[model samples]
Every structure is written in C-alpha cells, then in structure tokens.
Target chain A: MKPEEHQRRFENTDTLINEPIMAVDITRYCDWLAIMFYYGAAHLVDKHYAMRKRPFHPDNHSQRVDESRRLKRGNVVYKEFLLLYNAGLNARYEPIFYDQEDVKELKESYDAIKSILLTA
Target chain B: MESTLALSQSYKGLIADSILNILPYTLAKDQSNLLETPWGRHMGDGSYYTYNLLESVRQSIVDIPWWTIGESNNMSQDTCETELLDRLINGLLAFATTEKVIISQREESIAFWVVSSALDIMTQKKYCYFFADIVDKEFDTEYIFDFRIVSPSNRDLKRIPTDAQVYVRR
Candidate 1:
C-alpha cells in the first residue's frame, strides 16, 4: 500500500472512531455503537500489525483483540481494549439490550483506544 | 401476457392468535415524554427493563388471528420462529421513532445473536450458539440466523476461548 492509501485508511478509521460516537443517543443503537467502537480499535491494532510485519486484518474483531492481548500481555491496556471489544461484540450480536452502564463502558473503551490511535 | 402468481396466506400466528388485547401503553413524563412503561432490553433506548418489554411481548401474542401458523415449509413461507420474530421486532419498534429501521451496515454474526436470543426466550429452548457461520446471507444487507451462543454475563470470559462464545459482561 502507498502512503496515500495508508492516509486514506487512517481517515476512514478516524471517521469510525469519531462520528456515531458523538451521535450515541439511545441504548437501542448500541449494536451500531459497538461496531463503530470495534472498527476504531482495529486501527490501533493496524499500527502494531505494521510494526511486526504482519498483514493487517482490519475487519476481524476477534483476531485484533487476541493479538492485542498477546502483544500487550500482562498489561492493563489489554484489559481496556478487551472491554471495548466485548462491548462491540455484544452490541452487534446479542439480543440483550445495552443499558446506560454498557454505553458508558463503550465510551471509556473508545477513549482509551482513541488515545493510542491518535498518538500512532 | 402476465402471470398472476397464485399464493396463500398459509402460516397461522399462534402467538398473535393467542393474544387478547395489547397492554395499554401510556406516555408519561419524567422530564421528557416517556412510555408509561418505558421499553428496556435493547429494544427501548434505556438500560434496565423497569417494565421489561419481553413480558409485554409475551402478553401481546394475539389471542386469535382467526388463522393458524402452518407447521411445515410447504404452504406459507413464514415459520413459527419467523412469525414470532416479526411480532417481537414490531413490539420493540412500537416505541421507537415512526421512521423506518434500515440496517446500513452488515454485522451478520451479531444479528444472528440477536435473533437466536429472542427465539430462545419465545420458545423457552436453550439452544447453545456454537460459533459457526453456517447460515447464509442472501443479500448485502440481510440478517441470517445461524447457530451460536452468547453468555448473558461474562463472569468467566477469560476462562472460555474467545473463539468459542460471545461473552457480554453484565
């Protein structure tokens, strides 16, 4: 991929992290809420993937989290990353509704992952 | 020179047939207007099911549709599950905006999780959701149900392989 391509990808990822995140109005939309969170966090993983010369798998949620956990093993960062990962998965898959608390956790996880991506 | 394709409304609604009257919903005001019993459980916008919409769904199952949901795939296309599934979603949407609900993004796995959970609740069957995308998605924007399990809460998430189950920590 060219540098311009990389820039475009990052731009796309940036939208994922920022847009609907600001638009989170109801718990019913949490499914989409979770998808946005996962896509944003996946970008953070992209940086690590590049560092290790691994081909980036940006759309695979479980793979990114597993690799993040393995790379950041024995660290507090992985826990936070996992929180966002689970929230995103739940929002997408489960019939169970997300409450105020779940949405708050999603915001926090997105923030943590965003901090890493912004610096990357 | 046109074919008038013949069709029959075969599948009878047991749940809808069973329902007598919709439990009256009152829009009350805390600050903004709220449902007399605000919907919860991912259907309504809020968290806890203070009025628990599922119970309402259970009650809304029509007492008599004056017809029966067909048992086989022969006559009508709708299955019992799909029939109940429609009611459940409509029940949930009764409180949402009148605007149409369009799924702009594709999350096949997650959508399966939602449908199965509702099926489990309605049928009272504990179908463990093994992680396999065996079901097919016929279109770019379609929800297809497949087998899989997601724990209500992730008490032992780390103990279970992430590949095995979807754990939603309560």
Candidate 2:
C-alpha cells in the first residue's frame, strides 16, 4: 500500500483500539489509553515526516510536545501497552468515567489528528 | 498611530482571553494586568488608557479583505508529517548554503531544538505553561506568553521565540 494508505489503515486501527478505553467504568483503562493515544499520534507524525522528508508545522509540533508533556507529568508515561503507565506508577487509578462529554473530547482529539494527517 | 494603538489593545485582549481558555482557572488578581505593554498606559486594576498620536509616517495602507479562499484538501497524517519534514529540511538546506538562501532550515531546526529543550526543562521544573494544571503546586505559578505575529516578509519559523514572556503576579 502507498504510504498515505498505510497511515490511514493504522489510524483506523488505532481508533478502534481507543474506543473501548473511553467508556464509562473504565477509568483504570484511561491512563493506558492516553499513553497509547499519545505515542500512536507521535509515531504517526514521525512516520509521516520521515517518509515525506519535511518538518512538521510548528503549531502542530508544539501541540504534540504539549500533549506529550501532559502525559509525562501526570506520572503516566510508560512503555508497556496494557498497563496504566503513569496511573500504575502513581497508584491513582480511579474507575473510568466514560460519559458523552469525555467521549466527545476523545473524538475531537482523534478527528483533529485525522484531519491534519489527511490534509498534510 | 490610532490604528496601531487599537491593534495593540486588541492583541492584549486576545492574549488574556487565550490564557483564560487554556488555564484551569482565572489568572491571579495581581497578574491580571500582565498584558499591558510599556507604550500603553496602565490604568490600575487590569485596565489601560489609550492615547492616539501619529508618529513620523513611513508607509500606511488600510487592509483589504480578500474574497478568494483557497480550496481545502484532505491531508493524511503522513502527509502532514512530510510537510513538516520538508519545511525543516528546506530551512536546514538554507542554513547550509551561502548567499542567504532566505529559508534558513538550519535556524528552524535550531529553534525547534531550543524550544524542545526548554520544554523539557520546564517539565523538569514542574512548570506547566501550555497543558499544565492549576492544582499542582510546584513552581511559582506564572503565566508564560509566547506568540508570533507572522507576516509575509518574515515567514522564517526560526525567528519566533518559544517562550515569549513569562508573567508572574505583579
């Protein structure tokens, strides 16, 4: 598959994986999801830039860095995929609160990233 | 002079609003007037008094609204990344060349690195400016403002500073 096509497939898969983690009563799962979402997004950007041989827009890059820092400082930045990296470390795991508002925020973040990818 | 005053005033409001939106709560009572520039008069309590004066005229023209809008294209994640990489490469290439390539990829790369490094330090310092929460008390609570006014003549990304102004409670 072409690079763009490959990226789209990965995005679709990532979104699917992210869906269950955002549901209510899955708070414990959120830390993991947030980590995955961040790294996945970063990797996506990295791959795109490496293939295209261009630097990311400053605004987008700044935003990514910001998000990355948020996860890291929250004490959840981790390597393992399943474990709540920061949450596990801090022992602040709470029951998931997957409501329409939370879901909407997730969707918005996903949509923004997707839109940037599609257009770039 | 009147226009400049108005523009400056408008920008101050924009900056304050932007901060409020991103910050967890309202700015502290003392730090509320942090946006006032030296040229603008400080009217105690976060308000400003404006005076219009025409300085030596160099050149002036009213902005015209262009009706033409560019067509939208569907971009993919990779494409966006590629675009960013290309810009970086271009800037780098400019830096490597003589005769002023005018793009300065090297400078752009350097700036990016600087900002990234600063961000790392800030993170270590527990100073959250962009995505920091208000509840966590570690570093002195201060609002750092950094924005660029991009114009056609100065499109080079390197010139824009990452940490514009670090504001503390006055």
Candidate 3:
C-alpha cells in the first residue's frame, strides 16, 4: 500500500473508539504510525536519489552542493522530505507537547511528502 | 570594571531565577525531579548553583578590557559587550529546553488521561475527573495533574471519596 494510504488508515484507527482506554491505545498507535510514515518517506527519497546515480551527501548543506547537478536529479524534493521527516521525528520523541494542531501539521507534512514521492 | 561585573552577575541571576520559576510548572514532574535520576547528583531545587554558574560567566566577561576608540567617551571597551549579550541569549535558550520539557509534560498528561479513563470504566460511571501525581522517567520530573472526561454525566457519590495513585513508566 502507498504511504499515504497507510497514514490515512492509521488516522482512521485513532477515531474508532469513544472509550478512554481505547483513546489512549489509539494515541500510542497513531504516534508510532506517524513514525512509520516518516521512515517510508525517507526511504523513498533515498531510493530516488540512488536511481539517478546522483552523488549527494544528505548531511551536507544544500547550498554547498552544486545546484545545477543536484536539481537535475530531483534532490530538492528529497531534501525537503528529509527535513519534514526530521521534524516529525522531533515531534514524536522530543519533550515537547503535540496537540491536535501539531497532528494537523503532521498530516499536512505527510500529504506534501506523499505528493513529492508520487511525482518523482 | 567592578560595576560591569556586578551588572553581568545581575543578568545571570535574573535568567537563573526565571528558569527555576517558569520551568517547574512547565516541565513534566518526572523530568524535573532530578533527584530520582542518575544525573540527580548535579541538580538541586534551590537557585544557588545556577546563580553561581551565571555569576562566574558574567564575571569573566566583565573582566576583559578593550581599547576605547576615539570620540566614544560614553562607551568603554569591556569583555561584557556583544559576547555577553550572545552568552545571555544562549544561556536562556539552553535553560528553556522547551522541546524536552514540553514533550515530557505531554506524555504525563496523556498517561493521566488514560488512567482517569480506566477508572471511569471500572466504576461504570458516565464521567469522571481526577487529579493525581505523575512522574516522567525521561525528564526525571514529577507533576500533580488534573485529568477529566471530555463528556460529562450525573453520577451519585455512593461512598466516601478516596484518593487513588497510578504510576506509568515506559
């Protein structure tokens, strides 16, 4: 299944219960579900970069990389995906609060990521 | 030089005071309760240690003397100039530790919600609200939190109210 599809499924699962116990369980499940989506998106970017035989270092600043060569192989989109993935990870593991608003933000990020993967 | 040193020390003290006051309620209790952690040896509830650290840094900055330029009588070149400002900003940011603190607090809140829900279910009550102390292992802090049901209903008080304690760590 597509990463978007899986993410949607996970989101749906979160809405399946009215019970507090169920809600707690679903919350934990959704947190992990989001992480899975990040992994999927990161892998897609890595694979696309590799297929084009592009020599790119993920750690290097984009400005340092030769833009002319990197842009030809869709490095920009992949780089964007990596940043979003990192943000999602931060939301998950960092000692910060993730409210409904944060969840909405993550959903938007996932949508953008999936779009990039699909077009690439 | 002495006056500058005093001013620097004052700013540091202000920042440390802010951290102690703002962060306790802001951070997860489990995360803030350093006494329970292995690193607990380094922290204390009082402000003395933090104050001393800030004072030392400030003093170092104030002790530096730079050459005064021509026609700038109001300004004296001292160590505690731009570098001091940068250090103050950085020090506050470091103390904020917003991400780690907030995340730990949220986890505690979630756990509180779950436990409150379970109690409601076990009692077969339509709704319930609870306040309890919870700890976050990651942040080594403790908090007394209020967890309430989103939905409300009428239920009788059949028995004398008794307090319950729940602990969640993973």
Candidate 4:
C-alpha cells in the first residue's frame, strides 16, 4: 500500500483506540487494543519498506515487529513496538495474562510510538 | 568500552540455573532433542535454516523445532547466529526491565516465557545469562522478580546463595 494509504489506516485505528468504554466491557478487549495499536504502528513503519519491488510480509507477530525493528534500527519505536506486541501475544495466549495496569502502561508506549511514527 | 568477552559454558549454566530456580515453571522437560539440529522452513524455492527460538507447549517459552539443516555457508550461519542471539538477549532484557515484576504467579500456573541462545557451538556452550530473584508467591500474578543482564564476563554476575534451589534445564 502507498504511504498515504498506510497513514489513513493508522489514523482510523487511532480513532478506534480513542472510543470510550461503554456497557461492553472494554477491559475484555484490551488484547485487541494492544494488537490494534501495534498494527497501526506496523503499517506506518511499513511505508518505508513497502517501496521495495518484492516487499516482505511477516508471517507471525514476532516477524511483523522484527521487520519494523530491522527497518528502523536505533529507533525508540522498536522497543515500544515489541512491548505492545508482546502484551497482545501474552493476553491472547497466556491464560488470564491480561492486566488492565499492564495494558495501560503499553498504551503509554503506543502514544509514544505514534508521536514518533505518525508525525511528518 | 564494554567488554564483548565471550561467555564460557559454566557461566551460561549458572545463569540458566538462576532462572530456573526463581521462575515457577520450566521451558520444557529436558529438551534434549529440540536443539540437536537447526530447523528448516521452506522460505522460497529452497529451504532456509534460522537460529530462531520458538514458543513451547508451555506458551511463549523457547522450543527448537528440530528439522534437517538446509544448505547455508558456515560464515553466514555463524554471523546470523551471533546476531540473532544478541537481539534476543537485548530484547528479553528490555522487556524484563519494563515490567515491575519479571515473572508473575498466576492461579493456573501461567509460565513465564524466556528464550536462551547458545553462544559457541564448537565448545558445546549452551544457555544465555539472566538474573532471577523470587520476591512474592502468596498472591496471584504478584510475584516480583529481579532480573539483571550480565556482560559476557562472569565477573558481573551476582552470587546467588548456594542454598538457593537451582533447576538445570538441559
């Protein structure tokens, strides 16, 4: 996808993240929150590598974030991205691993990542 | 400059012991067959082997998927192995430090996933270094663990008490 398309998706996902918690337990969807934030950052970062004729598409969570790390070496986003990625994985796989407090910390990381990647 | 001195086998062993002692669960029960050979996955027309650590049955812990080693030059393999190991250690340590507690005790025995990569193959050196101190166990998901990354040299490793239980995963 073009950088503009990626930016659009990143902005859309940000809107979803900002949606207020209602009767539907937002805490239960904490995993999705982290996952969504990660993909938002992933797409934004993908703009850099997507220019290649044969662009790399990651197969798994690690591969996805690892690609971002490889492309943006020495960037704070790599560290924050891994934290969010791991949070999503742990929440999905590890039985009862999701803690609201932990996700809150990761949300801070997501904001930091967005400030870095989403800016012009 | 920080010493890039290679860690000896004994140091790795002790580090592994420390992790096992503090953490409630193990990676796998005697994963002898796991690391016997490198795993091969069909990347494109040909097979490619990676020194990648994988998740185990215990969730996100390291498990080597033993498959036939594919053709790759020794020089490239060595370089790849070194780079992968360094990345894993740095990433894991970063994750550990970010969270207040390294390992949390779950009501259902949720295992903490830790990955270790061998430094030297010729010397049969296995396991990566990590520090673990079990702080609390009574409450659910409230265990506090103190983890520190030691340099390649053994001099920096804080001595765990001899009486501290050491569980060796080999």
User: Where's the lowest-lDDT run of ten residues in candidate 4 chain B?
Assistant: B66-75
Residue-wise C-alpha lDDT for candidate 1, range A1-114, written one tens digit per residue = 443454467567667545654455544565666666666666556655655555555455544553453344213334456555555555555556665555566666567756
RMSD over all Cα atoms, model 1? 17.9
lDDT of 4 by residue, B75-150 (tens): 1224443353334333443442222111212232222333222111111111112211011112222222222222
lDDT digits (tens) for residues A1-120 of candidate 4 = 776777788788777877785112456676677677667777777765565587765555545554554443324655566556555544454433444655576677778767766553
Candidate numbers sorted by TM-score from highest down? 4, 1, 3, 2
Clashes of each: 21, 29, 16, 0
| Candidate 4 chain A lowest-lDDT run of ten | A66-75
- Which ranges of candidate 4 are over 4 A from the true structure? A22-28, A51-60, A70-73, B1-170
Candidate 3: tens digits of C-alpha lDDT, residues B34-144: 533332234566434544454455445334331111111112324544343233223222321111100112322221122111211212112110111011111112222
Error of 2 at B136 (Å): 28
Q: What is the lDDT of candidate 3?
A: 0.33
Error of 1 at B31 (Å): 57
Candidate 3 — which residues are off by over 4 angstroms? A1-28, A55-83, B1-170
Model 2: how far residue B53 lies from native, Å: 44
Write the residue-wise lDDT of candidate 3 on A54-113 in tens digits: 443344322211121233333334333333443444445443344444444444545565
Quote the positional error of residue B4 for candidate 1 in Å: 69
Expressed as tens digits, the lDDT of each residue in B1-170 for candidate 2 is 23422342244434443443423322222265554434436667654343111111101111211110110111122444434433432332232111111111121131122121111111212222211332122212221111111112333434533222111111
Task: Supply candidate 1's per-residue lDDT for A41.
Answer: 61
Question: If you assessed candidate 2 against the hidden native complex, which CAPRI class would it receive?
Answer: incorrect
State, as a TM-score between 0 and 1, how close model 1 is to the true structure: 0.37
